[model samples]
Target: MATVSQIWPFERRRCLKAHGIITLLFLDLCLQCVNGYLSSPHVGQEPPYSRDAQPVITSPVVPSPSSASPTDSDGYAAKCPSGGQCNRLPADCINCSYHHNCSYGKLASFSCKAKRGVHCTAESGKQQTNFSLSITCQFCWQLDLSQYRCSNSTSCMTVACPRKCYNATCQVLDHVHCLGKRVFQKRLYCNWTGGYKWSTALALSITLGGFGADRFYLGQWREGLGKLFSFGGLGIWTLIDVLLIGAGYVGPADGSLYI
Candidate 1:
């Protein structure tokens, strides 16, 4: 019926329709792969995205990816990675972690199956590496981290703690992940020694001891009563006073070592 030029319109329409269908199918396949389903019926192919998302901390990485682990002037220890694959994370990771940009390059294909109580913290804030955030992990039972905090009066639930305390009296305890999956009651306390001042503790003891409270507060139950019975140990007990002032030990209620 029609001239050669016009005759091809119908055929061209069919070709266009076929192309549109193929494009739709391709996009659908890509979507499935990005969603992390990995196994889609249509494509019958494995997903290319990794679902295991790693936690990125505010600290960059040990040695900037060019050198060894970041070192302290004293070289006592090397800086550890805040979370995982540091330095390799996206630059905006700090701002992106809590939102849609968590996966960065792998966003389309990567899905995180984090357990709330073990890996993630309920407290909203940035994660820090210089200041190690201490947390009490229930361990094993749950696949995520829920609540993590430093028991110090100046709580560190959300803030990154200092790298190290100076002359200030503080406790440093090493976290132990024992039994391969359980947290143990056992903790190694870095008892303050050598030369550190405890101005706050001294002030509290001297002012509060008149009521026998200071002695009791410092884990000297017997000494507290003795001091209470003896009126601040005015003269005779001055010798014991020296001992208490210099001695560093663990707080009874808490396992933290105090100076």
Candidate 2:
């Protein structure tokens, strides 16, 4: 009972509604596919977003097997001795052997062992394999208050001790140790004068320095001759020598201090 125009309009509206429903369903299907692809792990790729995924745990980087051995500054691997004996003594202990008898001070030497290991380059520019470092230490000792008692008039002074000691007491040479072995034994005063006198040196310098008498007494032949020819640098050297002898600067030619 409807007209043709009304029927056509109704059909067009129904077609439009069906088209909108299909478009909506197709858009929803596309969104679901995109979501599935993003959440799932693919070949050589991880999921962009995943609720079941665990936190990534990476392992620490380890050094190669070739780099396991210890190397020196020059990248040469340190070699151990075959005899199993290494020079573990410190440099100071080794150089103590070269010091003069009754001498005590900070000494230095390059041939001494710094640590327990065979050095790639030694003082002779050759690899040292022997662990035994030849050393001939002079007789030395540390002050032991328990060994002896000091008189009331006896004075004590501090001195630079190469080895550890108590109270910095003036110790005399009693024994010697080198390369971890006792080598010598001799009871001698460390502060021995060796026949040098401070008062005599000062007196000669003040009275007859121009004549080179102090230099001659100190056993300095060259300096004595030079002073004799220069007449003590026209009295200027004489005054300086007097000061030096008085202040204990000019010592005996034998490397011993004045008494």
Candidate 3:
């Protein structure tokens, strides 16, 4: 019985030692499994180490056009300059009357010889003002009254013209001859009178004609002395001179055009 008891104790001790070694091996395997689970990547998330390497996202910017009107340095719109004016003709104008319709501004009007059938027509023109660089465009229509446009050829028939008068030269006709001519075909001419201001001469002649005042005022020194000595040609010269002076026929001794 003692031998059997000793053998049973020895076998029990060996079995206990084997169980302890197995337990230690099982614990080491569990630790390895936990470490592998933590190191693996998640299904829908990036790895922590790769976060900073990703590129940043941004929206692009676009520019828009400007919507503003142009203005001068004075903050005002450009306009016509000084001494600039326009004159529009009447609707019923005829017989080359349209030629008188003109506009005068910073620049002079364009001139072209008129053909027999060709006549003046309305046209547009550009005028510049000192205030701005932009141009001032005007339609061709009105006549510019600010300018004086007249020539000697066209001055004679203005009063008798079928159209409006731009310039006319009228002379006095002899009373007897004028009344006798029924057709009045003859061209009337004004009596010869000095061009030295009819008003001034007439005033001086009346006030001092006997003293040769009219002649002296007309720059006629020799005629003035003769009239003064002749008592104005015994008053006959004074009467004739008064009539002649009233007419525009007589011009300045210097032959200069009337003012």
Candidate 4:
């Protein structure tokens, strides 16, 4: 049997050991509660736990619809059809491409130019010359027909709308004749003779100057025959050519430039 003094000490030691065990159990309960709020130990060591702590009060806050995106005032202007974002766009935005769906190069080109029509005049020469035409009045080229009039209203030269450039009985070279100059007659055509019939002689000179071929152009049978036989006054045709123009044997060819 334990004595009174020994029993008292033994009881005190048992009480202390019991208290320590209770304290350890309380600490373990505290750690279990903290596990709900925080992560578990990474390796093996348990985290510090406060034995005097109490449960915390919490009320979670939620988002509202209006606050979903306060920054977007226009609510995103529907991406540029060009497939671009609401914040960015292709060059063809003017064409209403919200997604940038059009070709990049084509969009850039479309934005670079404007629509316009073609305009022309004799003087406004440009990069596209063939696309324009002269706007000058062409009435000066019209033929006059008052010279062959027999009476106030009766005229041998009728002003037909469309006739040969130089029609007979139509004031015969009225334009140049009024200027008092020599002109071809219908008697013997002068392809190249000295006269106001400037075109035929010029044409003949350009087409037949080499072989004295203009002899045939002027309808001078004798001269042409001689030239063909002797090769252009190689013998004396040149002398004849000089004499004829001086004597007025030849006139402008094609009569009155009718052809």
What is candidate 2's local distance difference test score? 0.52
TM-score of every candidate relative to the true structure: 0.24, 0.31, 0.28, 0.20
The lowest-lDDT stretch of 10 consecutive residues in candidate 4 is: 107-116
Query: Could you arrange the candidates by lDDT from highest to lowest?
Result: 2, 3, 1, 4
Give the poorly placed runs of model 4, Cα more than 4 Å off.
1-210, 252-259
Model 3 per-residue lDDT tens digits across residues 80-194:
1222311221111111111212232233232222112222333233332111111112222122222212223423322222322332232222110110111211222222222
Summed backbone clashes in each candidate are: 8, 1, 7, 20
lDDT of each: 0.38, 0.52, 0.42, 0.36
Model 1, residue 240: distance off in Å is 1.9
lDDT of 4 by residue, 1-259 (tens): 7789989988999999999999999999999988855665554666699964532213212222323343443433332232222122221121111222223222211111100221222233322212211111111122133323211222121222232232222222211211111132121112221333334544554455335555566655666666667766564655555455434444434333222
Clashing residue pairs found in predicted model 2: 97-137
lDDT of 3 at 169: 32
Off by over 4 Å in 2: 1-190
lDDT of 4: 0.36
The model with the greater lDDT, 1 or 4, is 1
